[model samples]
Target: MSTVTSEIPAVEATQFQHTPYYCEENVYLLCKTLCENGVADATGSDLFVVFISNEKKQVPLWHQKASTRADGIVLWDYHVICVQRKKESDAEPLVWDLDSTLPFPSPLASYVNETIQPSFQLFAEYQRYFRIVHAPLFFKHFASDRRHMKEPDGSWIAQPPPYQPIVSQDGILHNLSEYNAMSGADSLSTMDPDTVGAAVSQKLGVVVSHTQLEELFTKLP
Candidate 1:
């Protein structure tokens, strides 16, 4: 197993603001904060925003504080997180999931093992898919209108973040569905790592199966 040495500095997870049940916004804020902190500029650590769900919009994740079960599993419609790909060859990629009960800035390997659990078999509907967007592009192109958090009658499903809804740098509003959508055909498991990186960097994002999560980020250039 790889370890994060004390020589490596990481942003404390608590330094960022988090709102309950608003993972997408939370991650957007996280990416913004990282950029403002100049972590990416200083370390050349590529940041990626990951959306976890499937065609059915159901994803099972463990070690979630929101889980009512003793095993700490939550069946979410969709979830979002930030992944930092270190420039150092010896350093493992890190996952920042504010909603997870796992250690803050968990190593990608440990997060995958404890939270994603790719080895665990489940029904086809419960299978998890990932949408990875390069943080620079995600921060520039992403937007949310908060429509997903409202009931059909426009009531609140959960309290929203205090800040205004995010708008894209290009002024496009509410493109959350584009990022969250994952079709079966979008899986990049068969493609070479370079192709996966190209897809994520050039396109809005790329979707890969749970088994491909760690491979995709770890091998990214």
Candidate 2:
């Protein structure tokens, strides 16, 4: 039952990033800002910000694809989110998913256990779910450090100031607009996600399918 105050400014950072791809870092930065702003009650590890990753075919909420579904949907590649529980206050833990692309801030279990039907009634081509992984780790984007195994072979390329991190409200909004833009005039209007999924899978070198990660999901119907 924990809720955000809505007082802090998205000018610093946010989870609702609109990058064409690679949202893990966006989520991480957003969590960092939330922690700074005391989203999970005065920060610290109690906030329980963990990284969730899994295989996905198309980008849910954004990707364009064919649909026999009431809302034929697609999935995204590795995604990240924050989880926290205020035992002393709220009765339930809240998922801080800013880029949720859905009604957002959905219950953690609902986001985790819900199937392609309820989830896809809005956007899913078939009844199939993929495996998702949970890790209690925060991934780093900028290579400020972690530069190891660097021989004298000029292994590290020099990145200038912009290499730091781009945290801007305007920029974020632009990216979000670009990412969520979907209309008959858009390119996805002509692309078939089912057929394009194979190319996506091959390029990503990951197995993306219209199948269920669990038999339970497959048998739900």
Candidate 3:
């Protein structure tokens, strides 16, 4: 929700650019301006702004921590790299210095891309019954203090419950938690999809057919 307004002039790239390239140039300029301001944490090592210069168009949004930097610097310090070049007449270069502007979208976007987006359809279908379907299963593999791990009824705390897998009609699986115990096992091989879907619906407090579940999964990101 934080808002940052900058009066600094846009760094113009001396070339005609379209929406995509112009956006990149703007981001580059924003980074340059932010690097000049030097608002990074003093205790942490200096941040360096980096991005691809077009050879690699699919530049990841995450600012990688330069492993070769000797100053113990972190990626958080230098967060922006306003894209340069490819400017067109009458097209305003856009800059997005996450350091000085809105919060960086990499972390959240990464989570969505690697986790949420892939499972979006599954989550949405399950959400109709259980709102918490999209939430990461609150798992407790081991407790530091086992003695203190007890429920309100004085019973031993049970292991965190895992959600049943919802398979799609096309056999495309999503949200497979590699860390989960049954992650290596294929749910469809042993258990029927209808049975699994029914259990999931029961746990979610809603009744849905396997086809409906598959449809829901198909509709999401």
Candidate 4:
């Protein structure tokens, strides 16, 4: 397959809105926004996938980490990213994870090569099974729910303030190291989160309440 160029000019990394703690979902929406507004030449509703890893075994896990509560409860079961094209002509889709500590819009090929050590995949059918709208609509209805996360210190704060870039300038190459495990693609196999996601969140000192879980899903299309 040939490489397809992006529809829109690739915005410099610094242009991205900075945030305190943008989680997996926030980036999914951001990428979808890029696609919808033709920012990256994206068209239609959007395309994204949700995936879950058992432990530190999943490389992406090492980057964004998962959503949790102050009491240390886990919320979301999977990490999701928008798989979109910068333009209609692009060959392979780009995987955009705004919260990723690795890089903002990782090429799907590179993403699969480095991340995607998976046993199961639940392609988030936002357009098919779920309805996806522009950010304004989402905010009008669910902004309050979407905002805020429990900090390690136990204070609740807003997430992904605005255009927070995925990876910081301080450790560009260092953050990329998370996917070092992907280089061993020949040895990789598919696997699911063997341990309960909540249990794992507890171990990480994060908590997701029942209400929070509902907000995570129902609020989105």
Cα RMSD (angstroms) for every candidate in the order listed: 2.2, 14.5, 20.9, 15.3
Using lDDT, rank the candidates from best to worst: 1, 4, 2, 3
* True-structure RMSD for candidate 2: 14.5
- Best candidate according to lDDT: 1
- Give a tens-digit lDDT track for model 2, residues 1-221: 22433422233223444342334445545556656666644433434433322222233533123223454343543334554544454334445555544334544445544323334443332223222211122222121121221347846333222234433333321122212222222111122444333222221111223232222111111
lDDT of 1 by residue, 1-221 (tens): 22574423566778998999889999988877877787654322378889898889889999998998887999999999988876665677778899988888888899999998878989988898888888878877889989989999999899999999999988988989988888667888566766776745664768888878877776676
Cα lDDT tens digits for candidate 3, 1-221: 21212422333333222222222223323333434544322211122222211111122222222333443222221122331111122222222333222223222223223312333353321222111121111111111222222577878654421223333334534322221112112123323455434322321212222223333222222
Off by over 4 Å in 2: 1-18, 54-72, 113-221
For candidate 4, lDDT tens digit of each residue in 1-221? 23444432475545544353443445445654665556553433234332332223232233443435332223232344555532235355556665454455666555544444232243332101111122222222222222235567866665434543333233332221221111122111321232222212221211222112212322223
Model 4 ranges with Cα > 4 A deviation: 5-9, 32-37, 40-46, 49-78, 85-90, 101-103, 118-154, 157-221
Show model 3 residue runs off by greater than 4 Å.
Answer: 1-21, 40-116, 121-221
Clashes of each: 0, 6, 14, 19
TM-score of each: 0.91, 0.41, 0.19, 0.41
Worst 10 residues of 3 by lDDT: 134-143
Best by TM-score: 1
lDDT of 3 at 165: 30
Model 2 quality (TM-score)? 0.41
